[model samples]
Target chain A: MADESGVLVLGDSTGGELSSMSRELLTAGRKAADDLGEELAIGLLGATLDQPSQQAISYGADKVYAVTHPQLAQYQVDLYLAAMEALCRDVSPRIVLIGRTNEGRELAPRLAFRLGVGLAQDCLEISVDAGSKTLLANRPVYGGNAIAVVRCNYTPQIAAIRPKVYEPLEPDSSRQGQVVSFPVELDPSQARSQVVNVVEEAAEGVKLEDARVVVSGGRGLGGPEPFKDLETLANLLGGAVGASRAAVDSGWVPSSYQVGLTGKTITPEVYITVAISGASQHMAGCSGAKVIVAINKDAESNIFKEARYGVVGDWEQVVPAFTEAVRELTQS
Target chain B: MPVSIAVLAKQVIDPEMPMAAFRIDADAKAVVPPSNIPPVVNGFDENAVEAALQIKDSQEASITVISTGTSFALDVMKKPLSMGADELVLLQDDAFENSIDSFFTAQLLAAAIRKLGGFDLIICGRQASDWDNAQVPLGVAEILGLSCISLGKKVEIKDGKVSVERITNDGYEVVEAPLPALVTVSNELGQPRYPTLRGIMAATRKQPTIWSSADLDADASQLEPRITLQELFVPVRDQQCEIIEGDDAADAGRQLALKLREAKLI
Candidate 1:
């Protein structure tokens, strides 16, 4: 009976590995399931995702349903939507959770529409309402200036949870669960959009999402050349270099390195914001960082209000020296 | 054959309005439109219009602009018309006045598109600036059983096929689909061109065709929002700034590093 109506978590895999966002969703799903007195099930759809299915079990999924097909290697809207829709029909879950990833954003809405369910996109928090027994999805609106607690009036409530908002539980190697193979058929003609090629940006060191220490520069840096100093500091800290939307829009940095509402959301141990005014949109992405250090010449900069430690100084004069100090401190 | 393109535009409260001026009525769970800052075309939707206009510029094509809301300020909605849209269709009804979710919006928009007839392509912003929910384009395409390319930075139609450069996490991907599809344009496509004097004057002569829910034959039941707003509030921050003092800028940098190290953050 529990298998028939459990909390379903959509496991997103990239390059045959479970995405960080998927793991985060599982963590969130676990809590919601516990609160609702239901079991948690994970759905993995890909050409090859056996390893990630087992990993999901260790992360707290009681059952793992994987659908594999050759056409599932690359993300196609039709194939994925059909697979998930089929799964939902087979196992009528009370709630469905998907990561707010590139693919998830596209798939979640379509699934909800097909299921005739309600959907909450890019949610920051998810919990069960004690009295109503309905799911409450907290999402930011108006560029993160305010948050709205949204509830779906329909069954099988669906939500696309943002990455880094919930921490994944520690994996227990000894844990075991049922792995079910779900069959799915794909026709070549169904795929309207075909991915000709994927071009990855040339980036060295840690990826922005995985970086523990993020060194981000803003328009305050004045130009792209100053990013070199940020790179040096990021390298010394063994982290990644990021940028504000202003810097990216100014053509000082590529869009991939941007950190803001329209860009990637990052939750690092330490986020060093240089010359950023901390616009609400930008803060929406990095507010999850454990500690924020802001450096700007303007004392009234908005970034300072959110930063744990702030230095009112020019980047050119402060960054190089800061890099040198960090290098020395880490070398010893 | 000349191509027919329909661009979806939305009027949203300017996202760039300063935080201090932004206000929300918690009880109503609605944003109080700052009178000083009037509603403008969502920035990304402007990019979508620009994408459609560029295609219109290079080829023989007709561009139709569509928007759905309770009341669209003509002054704001006419910006797309002034920029060279062949026609503007406004979907307005009192039932849509409240907080309608994306599903209902997409369903109505899809129905309206069907009523318009003979559109080879549909374009929409990656997401609205106010709600920031990038779901409508895909939802509309799903309802119409059409292909959708999301976050397209570049789009072109030739020989009844659509080619698009889609923005990805790392970089971008080149994808292709048959005509009679939809694509959502991102800001990476570039800033939209401003209207010229001649174009503005021509817009003054053009009137938008307004369609209510009755004309579209929209199902009032389906038009109802599935999602309900439970509560709305501003997130409060308890942290205060602790400015690190230093003799100079460089010294301040050193002190900052030391403080971070002490916190074991580095």
Candidate 2:
């Protein structure tokens, strides 16, 4: 399962399941291995992970290092990171990559500390330094104001990449790979931060991340009155409702419902911005949407520049008409 | 009681900087701003300052303000000293800002505090407005080997032990930890108070002591930047504006419908 460059990716599992960001890491890992002419191996650390290992294989992992143990079933920071660290020590990988999720953010740093090397987090981009084989990691700095390139001089150069930045490889069901199940040795008592409870959000229909169509209202909605209109439109079009940071800051909307850098990053099929001015910080989260439509009174609003289609009219007049038209089309 | 408390403060680019001042220089491949980008004590840090002051008001603890920044920070950081931190430590060497990662910053602060000694609590904003890393407290805790509770929206100290109410998505988690712990305050904790003119006048005479990487006994290798920033620029957007034209309301509805159909959204 070792590549020519000996690069291997360790897939992170949260809540006893594979995270969405893991696929993106695999994509980047595969690309990096391809560039280095190495086979990209994946170390999937979990308790019992046959299905997720096969899924990883389909996503361009050459070999899956299936480290299993009853103690590793849940995310215990110390135990989980120790398992991955032990795997890397044995495998002797030249480069290691992980998803920049909560688990990755915590694990990579601790693992790097244990391994006595530097670890990079939240990298928007990564490339191998041709001369040095140093993994160059580009991460957002200054609150999305600037990007800094981070490099590791130590062996097994590690990186944690943000999700959605790298497109996942086409999954092939027939793809084949080896799964070597290794026994993990650790006790749960060693964990620092215990997960007392795992509570999932109540809303089930369409997660903000996975939603194809999103209708977002902002502070300009004035109050809860226009929210009904926005929700009506979202429901009519089978979309989720998003709100700008301004709306959240103004207390017009909950922070969970806000869409921006601090909020959830969405890559919906279509996004409608109602009264959003498209500030740079806010745009970072929503820029991934496929089709953007801006509806604002100001023709020169920043949202207009980012939207694919815009209406420079009052949303009060435009929303109802837009809702009716969507119903007419979807119903037909 | 000889209890000393260190409050972490940061100077950030004012959150309300005008958009008109933002300009992208193609040659520099960076965002060129008009000279009016003023620095201020980050709003969250101000909350931390007020929290520190509240403790100093009643508990009779020595309050110290610690910050990591460059020359631009000195002006804005004065607010905290005026608000009543008994002393100030500014880590402003060239190497400090060059690296300035959470781990390094925490290491430096912990070293400085260790030199001073006898600190009961360390106060800081839950997250900084500029970096928003939220790692300093955790990093400091790990470095100093102390207990830390973050996102403290409400804090109360009694009998030398601290009671902190942490705001989470569900509701709040109230935890009681012993003294010599690190606590970071958020906006949800309380609004920061405005300094009076008398307080401002007193602050004018106060000077924060500047410490370098050497002063903190931090190794050069430990403080080096892991991430290198190549460029900074605003992302390009590809939005096109199209007005749905019609003379009447019915015509407008029909036109909008036609536009949706044409785009295959129907």
- Point to the candidate with the largest TM-score: 1
Runs in model 2 lying further than 4 Å from the true structure:
A1-5, A14-17, A88-92, A105-116, A142-150, A195-204, B1-5, B23-34, B43-63, B81-87, B98-104, B118-138, B146-206, B231-234, B243-258
DockQ of 2: 0.34
Reference-based lDDT, each prediction: 0.87, 0.70
Q: Specify the CAPRI tier of model 2.
A: acceptable
Best by DockQ: 1
Candidate 1 vs. true structure, TM-score: 0.96
DockQ of each: 0.78, 0.34
lDDT of 2 by residue, B1-266 (tens): 75678888777766567655655564554444347666788777888888888877777777888887656456578888777767887878675662425656766777887877737888888667555555666566656755566667666677777667754433346655677777777665666777778778888888878887667766566555544444445544445667666664444545665686689764
Model 2 chain B worst lDDT window (10 residues): B226-235
lDDT tens readout by residue for model 1, B76-163? 9999989988899999988666363787888889889999884899999988877777878888888788887888888999778889
What tens-digit string does per-residue lDDT give for candidate 1 at A94-201?
899998877776788889988877799899999987556689989998888889889998878899998789988998868888999998877878888888877777
Which pairs in model 2 have colliding backbones?
A: A3-A39, A148-B228, A148-B229, A149-B227, A149-B228, A149-B229, A150-B227, A150-B228, A307-B239
Q: Give per-residue CA lDDT, model 2, range A90-191, as digits (tens).
A: 888878887755355446655665665556666778887666666877766555555555666567787767667888888897988787887768875555
